[model samples]
Target chain A: MSTWSPSASRDALMARQQMYRSIREFFYTRSVLEVETPLLSQAPVADPNITPMQAGQRWLHTSPEYAMKRLLCAGYGDIYQICKVFREGEAGKRHNPEFSMLEWYRVGWTHQQLMEEVAQLLQMLLAERFSTLPTLHLSYAQALQSYAQLDVHHCGDQVIARHGQALANADLDLDRDGWLDVIMSHQVEPALPHNTLIFIDQFPASQAALAKLANNEQGVLIAQRFEVFFNGMELANGYQELTDAQQQLQRFKHELQGTQRSHDALLIAALEHGLPDCAGVALGLDRVLLHLLDAQSIAQVLSFEWQRA
Target chain B: MANYSSNEFKPGLRVMVDNEPCIMIDIEFVKPGKGQAFSRVKLRSIRTQRVWERTFKSGESLESADIVERDMEYLYSDAEFWYFMATDGSFEQLGASSEAVGETIKWLKEQVVYEVTLYNDAVVSVTPPNFVELEVVETDPGLKGDTAQGGSKPATLSTGAVVRVPLFIVEGEKLKIDTRSGEYVSRA
Candidate 1:
């Protein structure tokens, strides 16, 4: 194909447009107000795993999470935004350096409540290709135990490393959270049930990015976060917002350690100004469209993939 | 030696793993939305030719293997080592250890070009041509008009590699042999 040509077919692009319209309609009927935020920000997210693309003096926002949360703090209720997010060094069959993300927040909602809403939207959007199926809910610990034979809450670092190395078939030098991430993405995600929406929630506390910490039924501390998947591919990640400003600042500092970057002080300031309790989720729109169109690769649904762009 | 981070990993890149030179066969970028990133790679060991998978944390660096492949003409083996001369007009001769020569020694033909893989100036492996033309050194005499039976018999090539050829094939005739499977193709 010529370099000027787009990666997706004309038909695929049209389908994507239709999906965008359907998403807007879905939100419109529910009275969820749509909003926009700047793509570039003075400060990027503090999560070291997600690298933000730099543009001149500013960095392209990895997500509109901070800005959207600031809006929620400013008294915007039940808001949604569909925008392009940039993450450096992430490109593959299912990922691009720049991709579309649909993020939203609901006041006084928990991650569990947000998960049900996500299921409703997905069922409505994918009605043409699939019949509505029951959503499956599994805790992060349950997934690790069932798929990788890992007990994340109770296992030592060596045990997690052993399972990860065995699954990868080679040695892996990783920390506890690193090994857990490896097993989760490589083994557990692929082993989840297909043809239905699946929610894996209550992650280990160390991995809780912007989520509140809560005690589970067994009195073990867990992150109030959840991820949705279909056909073993992760589509969305949701979190019950951490309303404590001091705690949020500490978490950001912990993540930004060993890096030269600083946290988003504006977001922390907004958190301190009496923000209401909320839950938010960010969904990868390209992946959702890929699944809706039954496409094998994300590029097949993108007008111009990173290579062509 | 130069180093490569996980972000630079791709198929066909050779890197040192566990003190051995291994070539990457496949690579996949794996990361959770809010967790650590990893690069999962499938690699084949240069010495053992065994394939396995390994995952590396993002930003982790690996030393690049100083490996090179050269076109060389097979000379002869001296019990302990096989020798070859570079075909690049340099006429540089190099001796390969018995382990490096491995099973490809059975397909070695004098003056025939083959690929010699070297790591850090040491011969690590050799690859023979996919198809080689060799004269049959030993076989039963062909029976006239025996082609109709469609029977096959074992014929020893000049390189001492035995292959099954049609019953009509006669000794001293040059035949095309597939080096990979050690099977006869047809008369050269």
Candidate 2:
């Protein structure tokens, strides 16, 4: 009756609790140690696209990625964390400024191997609610070609921008990667088949700094990152960890130029100390619950959305 | 002029686009995995009442449009303009052009309160109430038990608006009409 009450229903709260339990059980069976890190950090992410929420002199950690990598460097193998992540000004029907994230790392695993584990975990959790769906994997460039009829790797900026403009229905001033992102979200995502788990990997090299870089069979450079989508919702993102300290610092510096943000010195130090070979993924728990309950908005699964919080 | 960033956009927010005042009818925040965020919005031009969609990258800003809305009582209509007086006891009179009144002119009734939108202190649009009561001036006599057949005939209201009423309706009867659909609701 009043705004003081939570936006989630009683049943939704129960479903959320059940989801957490399932996630923890999944990791426990795999022997992945659960870890916790401080929500407040001394340094913010250097990614220009993400804005960190500041509290006094410190910033809220956008994700537990940095700290978890630190643990890996310190010889903690196969770690998982379930925590609340903060991103400023990201509220919408599917987004909340503060939302639950389930991040984990697997030692001695490739991004492709990690994808299988992710699919297995999702199947276990969504078994009772949804029917079994065949998991499909497609490279970013292949997905673009199949759905939008454009080659992301060889296409010129004008070609990509034209596609972006046609999908957005207006002219946009954007770089090549920005226009590719627009097409991925506007055209490729909506056109993805429903009732299926789709993973789009081999992102443009510039799009992912933390992920390792590799060349496809066509000899085109691409990032070893993948995204999971279901029912048109972006559910998770993952990477084959980049371990070279110097290369990592260069990427951070390149991204921080105009962002006016500082890179995490401790994270760099951890990389310098030798982070073990690993692959990691971060999944939006709230969004996963939205799919489980078949709800329309993220607020229906969150205990208190941004406005209420 | 004040400016609004993409994050500040929401439904009913008025902003300037292409040097024209438009209102945001819907906004959706979309971000691809590990990419820049964007705000997809549907805006309706105030002057032309035409709606179109646009996408703005995060942090992109737009100039704000200063607009105001108020309740006014309909007074009378001239050849080129319809007159109204402020209902807030100010007794301030304003004349809105025929373009501003648009299709609402068909439902206009003297002394009825209507919403008036002003841009730069000039009337840009008028909205009639959802339901208006008017007396039927012309219709055939009511047919006994015709309600069971669900048949209806045309009736003309005192405001010169025509609507379909049930066959049981007769002339000179007060009826509630839905201004949006021009259909008879019930006896007022």
Q: Pick the candidate with the highest DockQ.
A: 2
Model 2, span B1-188: residue lDDT tens? 89999988989999998788899999999997588799999999887788998888888899999778899999998878999999999999999999999888888999999999899999998989999999999998868767654688889999888888988788889999999888889999
Clash pairs, model 2 backbone: none
Residue-level lDDT tens digits of model 1 in B53-101: 8878778889999889999999888888899999989999999998998
Which regions of candidate 1 fall more than 4 Å away from where they truly are?
A1-4, A126-134, A167-173, A293-296, B135-156, B164-174
Q: Candidate 1, residue A259: CA error in Å?
A: 3.4
How well does candidate 2 reproduce the true complex, by DockQ? 0.62
- State every prediction's TM-score relative to the real structure: 0.89, 0.91
Candidate 1 lDDT by residue in tens digits, A1-309: 348788899988888899899899999998999999999999977988899989999989999999999999999889999999999989888889899999999999878889999999889778877877678999999988888876789988888888877776667667788778878888888999889899999999988888999999999999999999899788999999998999999999998999989999999999999679999999999998898889988999989998889
Tens-digit lDDT string for candidate 2 (A23-89): 9988898899999999999999787888899999999999999999999999989999999999998
DockQ of each: 0.56, 0.62
User: Clashing residue pairs in candidate 1, if any?
Assistant: none
